[model samples]
Target: MTDVSRKGSLSFLNPFKTRSGSRSSSRASSVVDFKIGDDARKSSISTATIKETNSSGRTSRAGSAKNSLEYTRSSRQGSTLATTGEDGWDRDAQTGERKDHTDLLHSLVDESTAESLADKAQAMFIGIPAKPAADLFSRFPEGVWRRIVEFLGPADKASLAFSCKPFRTLLGTRSWTDLNSPQNRDAKFDFLGRLDEQLPNHLLCFQCGIYHVRTQKGQEVLRPTNVSNPIFNCPNVFNLENKVARHRITVGRALPFPFVQLILRGQKYSPEHGIPIDSMSRRYKDRDGEWTHQTRYVVVNGHLLMRVISSAFATPALPPAGLRRLLYSPSDNFNPYFSVCAHWRDGNLMPAVKCALSHIPKPPEGSGIAGTSAKVQYHFHRPHPIITLCSECRPMRRCPECPTEYLIEMRVQEDRSDPDPRKLFKHAVVVTRWSDLGDGSSPKSLEWAACNGEAEYDSFTALGKRAISGTFESQFTVDQIPGQKMVSMNPNKIKLGEKGHDWY
Candidate 1:
């Protein structure tokens, strides 16, 4: 509708429509000109023309009616009109009171740069400190930061000092000096290991506590134990007295500490820093004994886990001497061809395998001797190919000295080399060992050392009821292997090595 705004100027007043879809006579409200942009939340609607008419219908103050903009809304009870002037003053036109001041955080950014409510809420919930809008850390004295640095370990202290130049200046170079000391070599290794992500082309040499250039880089491949496969040209590699760290995987396979480092680095950080744990897996056959081995790995709780399946066919109804040759590598260290913990001889591991092997069903042999006819006829009855062990050997066996678990199973597999079609399949003894190789942090790690028979370890107290076998197998096979029975290799808590007759 039309109305005399002020100074006899004709202005358009927006009509208030009722529910009946018709304009209704509205209450007399003061006119406030506001340049309302499309976004009312961010526009400077208050900074516009302001005019008030008294009860006598006389204009108290007025601006250029030809250029001033006007806006209208349904005025409700307890609602004051928004008004501002050319001077950009924020105040309530009705109460004539100034607007409240914005706080330090809000004042930094104007409405144009203001963060959305969702972004602000996310920042608050995530505890991300607002960008250095102020230098709060500078208020603290060097002595206070030094005290904080003293409480941290060598690695953490170095990390804090290396975080930023201000921190480096405050914490001083003492942390770096402490990390360089020989006594804190492990801490130095830990600190260097953290930089694996940043130094993808380099690998942390734990022995030297430095990042050596990755000589092989992406071309790194796991070779046999005897093969010289060096991922990095470390000074400690050829030092006979100071041997590079390694763990025995099987008879001819050794997992170098560098591979373990790279594997875990890939898992913990990025693929460029190290190789994938799946790449470390392998399947190979032993030159002797016709034993086949398949190795797989899994990372859990930051520790590298290994599972090796070694299977070889056993002649049915073999003698004790024959069982010895099948189980032990007499030509080598006399250790089992299958993967085993260092303390295998000190416990019932060998005895348990012998028991499992004895359960194999013996095939009947009928070669009749010539009685009166002087002719010979041969007949042999084949036994059931599938063999299942008794309750004693079937359960999973854990090494009390280390984080290693073993499960022996008998499966009838086709003997591809067997020429006779009738004897194509045979019962094979499969020994699967699951072990924890530690976190690849250092060479002297308890699990790694205990696995190599260098350090003492108590697997029961450390591992509790959770079996490594179950943890690793659950990654791929969806609980196909049951680990209900986990007993110590040394139930009697014995400590006899090769001196004991049972192991042999």
Candidate 2:
């Protein structure tokens, strides 16, 4: 019997305890060797022993050949493979193939898996219906709302309301009220509707007359300052009086006031020529028992007085020629008109008639011509107070308390050597009352006509001529009372000179 004893650390298990036989021995040893080899390879033993002889003492020896063979077989079957474990690969069981662990992990969590998770969570949370969006301006305080409205321009405010439902509900009502408020006076709608009409083109004053012209090109060209330019430098400036003098010669053609000529005709004098009278006797006693003589005369004082009262000469009449001319010619061959000369001073014109009458000495009271008295006053029929539209002149006019009336005197020079001799004619007619004609709303003064005696008629006629000639002058005074007057004067027909006059 071959005896084998397990020694050292294996002393506890007896190696010689099993039966020994030739056939049994060989099979049993082979089987035991196989089991030992399997245990060494599978359990990772540090040492291996061959039949207890020859103790070579190699403690770190590798496993026996049989054990190595068994390990190779197990590796091929992919049951238990010994590896360095550096690479991240694991052997497969059935095919014995190496597969990447990272690849396997990636396959488990892919795009489809992440999508499934997200869909499930979204379905769970978003199941309920959504409410409408809240109004953006609902929670704003009143102060904030006011600020917001102010920040938005007119167009922006209108557009914001129409943008969306919530904005319309909150801002539309408030914006409308704010836009229509009186504080927004410069707003397009407010200015166009209320202010534009009442103050169109502003106010203007030209040559003592006030007017309102329309605005051109959306702007007022002539400013209030421009209207007052003439009056600004000197309120008493009468330079334009000369322009009026030049205008008189062109009466009915260039003169602005046409009615003045008509008024003058009624006052023209027609006196008999070559009537010799003594220069010393101021009174002229006619053939009749009634005596006609000089009376009070009118005069103007001021720088403009001379210019305001001047006479305009009339053109000669055309000579008769055709058969129609005979029909047009008057049966009375004598002309009843005469020309007079006048001068302007201040803003007034003194008629030559007044000057001629003034040259005659005033008779004593109770004399045959003593009852005659001459007076002149302007009648303002429009009734409204005159407001000075010209800024240069402060508002001034005749009023009951400070009545603007004057007593004036005129002087006439008689020079025989002078080429154009002075002449007089009888008054054709008298006008007691004249209509106040013009647009009443403006600051225009009333027009006057003659009333009563031949002297009065001639006075008015000369006055008309002066006005049309642009030689009419006016002065301010406080002597006369503020009331209407009616007076009369004597009538006489006389021839002025050889010069023929045309009726205009």
Candidate 3:
């Protein structure tokens, strides 16, 4: 009643086929046919399983290029999961090796400080192409890229050069070679047509007084002074020359205030009346009746020092007009100060902006108040910031080893209350910064510091003979050594004695 016939027929088909041989002959025959069909189906499934495994293995091998660990481990982990049809495509691989690989990559990315990497990450997030900067730069034509770099200044060129190899090479090319090179520096100075063109931006050397302009690559470079380029013996040395003489600019030292004050006092009094200052002096009169004499005044370490070199006064005439006349004029000889002469000779035109003082001279007593002297009042000109040579000494001996030749000995002497006209020009040179003469036009009149007493026309007219002004006048006159001198001069030697033989 419960389908006993159907149950008996299905029993013959079981792997452990039911042993019902006597049950029915038809059932026996049916069991043999079913066995043949089941065997065929089992064989087909086994073949398909083998094919699927091989195909998955091949797929894993191919994908190992990108995600090698995942592919290899999935294969070794077994085909049970695949055959069983589980979703394990993105499953993690064996822990140790996989973790190490991930950590190394992460550390590498974190270590770099380049903004480009961060930019690339941002680009990745924003769906932009994260092409490398070097690659992008490489895409441009070399000439075009070079042209872009040409416009950058000293600082910008440095930053760009460090960015990539191409930029560095571009800078090394002739267009941007080392700025400190002799050729480059000479060209730069010549092209600008003025030495002071780059002065404001340059750094003043602490060892020498040269204001060094930095290279385009942002390097503080100096042209090496070898035997071939024997301009100055030391690279640190900067030579400043003028009509007066070559002044070796060394590190400026602080001058004593009392000493400077003494110099100022002497300069304030004229040598003829009181004691004429030996250094060159100029007198200027304004539209009003006031007289002013311009000389070198330096304020160093907040102390005022009056420094006077042996310079000659200029004959009263119209000041030089135009840049050429002002720079190269032979008659421009009012260089009592070193700084003033240096600047004037270097073609700086700032001091040339002179205006006559406001105080015009009133006629002296007698002759119904008529101006007695032809040049009653002096016309004052503003002094230059940079000083040059005031006068050239007679050519003397030069140093044999060095390019130096002794021109003239400039004396720096100290005078304290012992009034003697014979003992002057006997001290060390003390250079300092010049005080600013505000635009050459001041409401107040400039006072004649060295010639304050009754002015003597004869002493004023003397070019190089007024010797009582400086700290010491003719007490000691030392001569500079020539570069080619075989031997040094000894004052103690030479048996020639004074005619009177006055040793005492």
lDDT of every model, 2 decimals: 0.75, 0.28, 0.31
Estimated TM-score for each candidate: 0.69, 0.16, 0.19
Using lDDT as the measure, name the better of candidate 2 and candidate 3: 3
Return the top candidate by lDDT. 1
lDDT of 1 by residue, 403-478 (tens): 9999888888899798999889778999998999998877888889989988988899999977888788777864
Candidate 3 regions exceeding 4 Å error are: 1-144, 150-166, 170-183, 186-504
- Weakest 10 consecutive residues of candidate 3 by summed lDDT: 436-445
Q: For residues 313-361, could you state the per-residue lDDT of candidate 3 as single tens digits? A: 1212333342223222232232222222121222111221111101112
On TM-score, the candidate that comes out on top is: 1
- As a TM-score, model 3 comes out at 0.19
Give the clash count for each candidate.
Answer: 0, 44, 61
Decide which is better by lDDT, 1 or 2. 1
Q: Which stretches of candidate 1 lie over 4 Å from their true place?
A: 1-137, 365-382
Candidate 2 local lDDT, 307-350, one digit each (tens): 11121111112223321231121322321111112111112111
